[model samples]
Target: MGQPSQKPPSQKPPLQPWGRLLRFGGEESEPPVLLRRRELTIGRRRGCDLSFPGNKLISGDHCKIIVDEKSGQVSLEDTSTNGTVINKLKVVKKQTCPLQTGDVIYFVFRKNEPEHNVAYLYESLSEEHGLAQDSFEANKENMFHVTKDTSGAGQGDEPQFLPPLPTTQVCFEEPQPSTSTSDLFPRVATSSMEPPAGRAPPSSPDGEPNPNLHLLVTDQGGDTLSAPEGVRAVVEKPDRMEEQLTCCICQDLLYDCVSLQPCMHTFCAACYSGWMERSSLCPTCRCLVERICKNHILNNLVEAYLLQHPDKRRSEEDVQSMAARNKITQDMLQPKVRRSFSDEEDSLEDLLDLSDEDSESSDVSQPYIVCRQCPEYRRQVGQLFHYSGPGSEQRAMQAPGDTPSTSASVTPAQDYVCTLQGSHVICTCCFQPMPDRRAEREQDSRIAPQQCTVCLQPFCHLYWGCTRTGCLGCLAPFCELNLGDRCLDGVLNNNNYESDILKNYLATRGLTWKNVLADSLAALQRGVFLLTDYTVTGSTVLCYCCGLRSFRELTYQYRQNIPASELPVAVTSRPDCYWGRNCRTQVKAHHAMKFNHICEQTRFKN
Candidate 1:
């Protein structure tokens, strides 16, 4: 319920008249409503203009015009009078509504029937009742309104307060009242340039009607207020702000942080310089770096967040948080952005294949998670290592070769911890406590694996059989049960054969040898490079035969070095052996074993 908007007239007046327009909301055809002397109580409803005067209903007091612009009903309540009646019913204002054409209302001032004065400007409704309308108005027709100068104005001529109605409403054709805002404060309805209901506003014949046209109002006294068109706009106050990223260097803010040319990656002035020093390209886009800018929207968000939390200490964590927050902001502004998934998830097929391969080996060759919750890294290669070189002496001390393993001899770098097992790794060599398996695990009680006596490092057995041998000197982990021939029980751990050379030579002349057991026997074989004074490859040949596995390394030595072309070829039953010079008798090629004894003691002699 509001009055129609008014446009400024071209005819000038030095000053506008003081007046307030009455707005009608109820229907006009129906007779105006009335009030009775009944609903009033002891306490008056504060802040309301209509109040009961000691058990009496009062109307036409401060109310002037009674008209209806809309079809709604209008009424009032007497909050103090107790004798008031609405249609012969004694109801409080809380119960009875205002008067209507068909409904009868009664009011009495002490002892008489209250008179209904539908007067427009009676003493009870105008300035005489201490009720005066204002004349102040802001000609909103002109977006930019300029008021008249107050200087040289005559006394008693100036209006007290002007109705600051946004007068620009007349420029638009659509009619709408500020119902929402009206409840809050007295509001002046504004017209919209939108087409009028049922029909559009009449346009000029030449089209583009009233271009450069503006609304201006002038009073008879030469006072003027003109509105500049299209100047007034809805100003939006910031509702909320989001942060995105931060500076890598100072961690303070990115100054002149221009978004990268290609990728739109934002960075500060000093940061880009530092980054360019190492590589000439944008940190984000990887584009060739030619120039940079200082003002970047992304970086601005970061700076703003850090600025708000002044007491917060900046750190890698803070930087990361800032980056995540800023990313959300950026994504909000620009959706359709791509994001990367976890490496494991992305290469799921490869990981599954690796798992299958490891399953065959009982997870021995499988990889373990060093720390499953390792913070996400924004850069590639999520880890760093200390290599052997200058400025790496600290790492050398930590992992010294001369020292034993971390558990016993050597140490490891702080950056790395063993991850062979959930929290422990087993060594295949010396079947002892291994450091490699002492990695973190999901389990509370971590079980570490033991070391192997063979490799000294942790291992998951790929081959079957017991490889835990006694000859650790050769780093073999197998017993006589696993190996076919030659029992290495004595020579592997501590030789327990004869202490003398000659005695050990004749000890086991020829029985099927699988394992050795005598410390005296090992002692007897000491320094006796040759088992017998038999004809050799012109002298003697040494064979370093590996007992743990089926492998052997044969080395042929001669007093004189001769080229292969000078040697004579000979045909023989064996294909792996060749003839040597001097001592004939073929000697079964370069070297062959002739099991013979000092006397007739050996039965399998040749």
Candidate 2:
């Protein structure tokens, strides 16, 4: 079996004529697999050129290493469940990736542990590089333990691994005429790399190999046209790009494409937005969608493809339906700043300034109107007031004797009309209709409606000049409010573990809510500021008591800033808590009395 037979030179070119795989890892001593043809399949299949019979991960027909004879370009097309990896990059199943020199191939690269799974180092071979048949025959017996003679030439009963000639002298054998005996082994009988029985090889209409056949799908009987050199540039056919461009959700051409993050799977923006209404996971990968962003690059490619095939363009009705379904936007990925109540006031002033500038300046008698969104029942242009300064005569306007909130102002009119009339949202507080401007100002915190941290529901708290009845404050109270007890009562009252921590801390002190309030008031009177005095902004979604405990823990930070002379004598003399604010023992009554909790940690031993 190891003896080299006196065979004539092959007439047809080899599948891959420029590269050979050097065995490594599991079989470092084995002979190199010679790539001698334009395409060589490697797997467990006996008919495969490079068969791995023992490896379970390697599929029957795992993958093919294809080489372009004229261009000398090498590529690996993956076709296995375990998949193939070249140069650390996993080749997508059924997709091709160009191979490069020094690329390492892995059959199954385990993430956690290294295994003896077969690995190969790709070496690009030149015309000068050749392995003599004698050197390869030395290791033939061990390498052909599983490989058998599929050709059935009746030369020997013992199986032998018949590899193609070395890269430097590679050749493809022409297909022999069919015979009755050869028909018995339909797949393995022929050594020639020809198309399967009855299936003609894919080629251009001019009887030449299609240069862009890889881009044009052949499984669906795609038409192959050969354009004359100057007639048209050979771009990928639109049909070939259909599968890549089509939206997985809608099963149509992608319109306003968007990509889900983490997974990086793409779909139509409207399709995904609608899908998110029911589930936040990606439709393709089932992974949680952390963020969504416009796939501008894919959108551009889709647009180019649609330009070539206008029929693939979605109709106006379908486009509108998609637009209506779209809820998520690129703004969701934007960095959101937790806005304070003052930020809204600044935006309101800016809007007022703009409105004043737009009014006619010629007539001094004509009063300049500010809020057009407000109803006629509300304050008129002449009645509007501006808050200049303490010295200025202007003062905040007083509500009408009837209280405008009680009037029809809170209710939407039967014939109300505006640019965004259909998109108006009723304010939860005022019960008044306010135009939803989130779509227009989503990227800007100053203009967008502030959302509650706990509920994540957008509230009509900003000054839109249309209504002033809503809670015009940072309803998503922060640590500052929690520390000062300014947060609305009962809003976040809940029985939870975080709340229990606070309850235990207070109970151990034998102090009621009134006692704590009085102490905080006394501290304010003595000019002993808490953490909120230095930092006025921050948001939280924690339950009421938990928020208080978080603020209480932060109180030590402000106390540390005070000079010993400025600090209270009790706190100045009290020993600092070993774990400081992060003290797990703070919840224990004995530890709370032993050490001062209003100071930074003295030891970081833990």
Candidate 3:
């Protein structure tokens, strides 16, 4: 009877679909299309699985969306003439790229008239993906908001599309008309070289009018801008500051910014980490990436920018993806020893017992070397090493067959003298004795004593500072660290490579290294160059090459600000180079000597 009443098997719930595409920012919004099939074709023609008849640019078979069964990874294959854009990145025709959740797909991009553009907001339907279809549907009304361009380009006539970013957009309405620009904007300026109104133009210390100053005066009507008397309107177009805040690798705003050392160029930590897996060279400058450190300053600036432009902030799913890929950590910020101190430091009683056991087991004495510069040295009985000399201050070899006692000795008749001869390391820069950190190095290379990154030679400045036992004055000067610029060309002159232009310029100006330092100091004092908190005028936390780079940059800025009257007449009279510092012609001594490379490029693509 129990077998006859057995319950029927319960039906299983339907499996969640993998992907969906929601049409956005056109003449009208449409319901999202589920990507249920393994491969689906999209086009303008009726034969295609996903057809958009309104889009004239789409071909009969424009692109194919593919979903991997096992991995749940979705990818897009573009086959259209107009091309497909995934999150602002144009996909090469016939190539496939894996699509991430919240990626925007554009069949054809029309910068103006976004309403005419064929666009789709890609969403992964999985709840674990953090972009469930219901969440997108719930916020559908406030999804795509087109606003006026804030870059002050084209008189703010063109509308800016915000849907492609896949982020939360807090709508910012137009500010009410106000007399004060500050009321309307945190910073407001025309896309011109003319300095903003109300701020005094920078002048030289001698009270001479700055030749570089191009102040524009607006009429009372405020409809037109005009240059002052004898001041030519430079009419330099403004650069898009927004581009500077984005990572070149991801083509998105930076997150967890990390700077590539030697180059000092910053990028998103997760983006750069992915790049590093393929190659160790910096993507922007092509410089060899030596070390990476968090760019705290740039991170702060990025946070500030995101606060102002909330729409540019990445979605939670994108943030989680990037966090998983991030390789840089706080541990990379500082050097650490290989082993924990707790493991290295045992009880004194235990150490004494071990020493006694060692003494009883062996007749030969173990040798230990101490730094001569150390403050105190004592030869304890049954110790690993012993010092023998007639004078307490002088160091010599111990007499043969002089066995050390196993027991502790009485108080010394005179003050104990520190010996220089036993088991000490020599400072790479000063050739002076210092404590050996070999034990720490043996445990972990990252925690090893400070050394020159280029030559791999140990320095005592950091080692002595850490120990807090040696005199600071005994350490070598910071300059011995060989501080240089990003390229490290002029300062680190080798027979293999040298900057001829730098050499000739120094010679022409009758400037020595001392003069360069003086000018850099003067630049700092005059606010021509600013230093971070970690960096002092004479001391810096940066490595030798980086420190030198700071000085080199400051020196260049100082030289650029100097009036023509102060410079050589021939140099001032030389025609300005069109390509500026980026000129390939500068490699030739004749071209470098003929034109100034410190100024901005006058000739650019229109």
Candidate 4:
């Protein structure tokens, strides 16, 4: 009995088709055709759903729009080399971004060449509602259908249905006679005349005819109405006080009116203040007003007028407040003095002198060695490597050596210090100090031992390979970790390999590195460095023979001449520089061997 009355199966709802109405030209231009497909492919290729052939800006498969029938959601995926921007924000390549109604999309050809780019306005539509379809079809007659010519030039031909031009006709109407007395005296009574019910007879106070009413209305005889004998009708000039009250600059009823001195021309306080920045002259007559002041009488008049027309007061106040905020921001952004090397040196020297005096005054005299690695030296117990010496002056004067003396009471140096002594090994990749052989050997047994050819310093290699690979062109040793899979041999074998590698590397860090590399390359080409023969490798700028160096070393080598302040600091910070002029001779020999050049002309001059 219960199974006898089973309900009929419920019917599923129809899937609503979603589409986009892509507008190409300006907003005032004719509407675009409504694309009703589930997926719309847009590109310059002939196979694309919407193709723009011969347009270098559009890639073969520029982008696609996908409409989800179930969710009624629309998304756009960019697939072009130039990139697609939505609402001024760049859409991620190969990633779908949700699109809303009235979203603006731009196909950027070249970032700097925005003029050549194309823009489109996106409008989402649903098949459930026929309004969008009807409107699109209505305007379809006016829209152009583009077709490629057999000769290969892409251009749109005129539509099939052309509307006929409308003809213009001329007609003239006969003049009509005037009926009202106010029409007879048009100029006098046009603005001030009252309604017929409000109109009253001219009042004769003290048995005297009103002169004002005589001027307003006149009979067919051209005489004043009910006037005293010999009293002629004189039209008093229309009150032009409102015209005088308007600001010359803003051309509106003045707010906080201020008058220029000598010229006495009135303007809105905010407008005049903004104008004074460019010119101190009156905008109307161009008269100089160096000593400008607010006209309080005119300001009162303007305030009275503003009270009657209360709409403009808020806007004027807002303008003044915005200007004040802008001024404050400008003041905040004023350029500040940057610290220079001389200032840093002076401060550092003062600090060192103070520390020396403190050590002389203290009961327990501690021996400190002036670090030859870094510029600034502050006397802290464990901050510097100190050794027992006869005096502080002698300790500072002692020759810079790598050997750790037995008499030396070694202390850990600052992180930036690179004296190349004790357990400090400079990393071949970053040119920064890493754990030395002792530290690496103590920490992990699996750590493979390696040495940098440039610095001749031993280090542990965990990633990539243990031994450094020499550049095939320059014969310079470079760490595999830093150089990635790139090598000079690969670059020489294939010309595009280096460019492809650089492009991939630049993509990882974003495109900003290209400009940095360009600037460094320019500097190198200009012979800014003592060692001119160098090349840009990824983010690092390396000397052709000596490999990578710290930024400080590069700066020192670029200058060629040492500054007095930097003399106390390490003169020979890099291993090549530490080896003296002989290092250049050896580098030339290696360059000659790798490049197959004669060493006679290429020998180190200095």
- Tens digits of per-residue lDDT, candidate 1, 1-606, equal 121112222366433222122212324653322222222122111222232222112321211112111322223333211223333332222222323333333332122212321111111122321221121112222312322223333321211111112332111111112111111111122322322233322222443222112122122121224434433423223212321343333323344455544455665554454444444344544454333444545655655765885433234543454454342222211111123423433353343333223233444555543321112210111233334455454443333222332122112223333333444343344342223432332252233222233233443221111134442222222222123334333321121221121223325444222323122223223532222222222111111122222211000111011233333232112232122222233233223222111111222334
Of candidates 2 and 1, the better by lDDT? 2
Q: Which segments of candidate 2 are over 4 A away from where they belong?
A: 1-262, 265-283, 286-511, 535-579, 582-599, 603-606
Candidate 4's C-alpha lDDT? Answer: 0.40
Q: How close is candidate 2 to the true structure, as a TM-score?
A: 0.25
Worst 10 residues of 3 by lDDT: 1-10
Per-residue lDDT over 215-252 for candidate 4, one digit per residue giving the tens place of the 0 to 100 score: 11112121112323223333333224544665544334
lDDT of each: 0.28, 0.46, 0.49, 0.40
**What is the alpha-carbon lDDT for the whole of candidate 2?**
0.46
TM-score winner, 1 or 3: 3
1 versus 4: better TM-score goes to: 4
Poorest 10 consecutive residues by lDDT, candidate 1 = 552-561
Model 1 spans with C-alpha error above 4 angstroms: 1-423, 426-481, 485-525, 529-606
How far does residue 562 in candidate 2 sit from its true spot (Å)?
18
Q: Measured by TM-score, how close is model 4 to the native structure?
A: 0.20
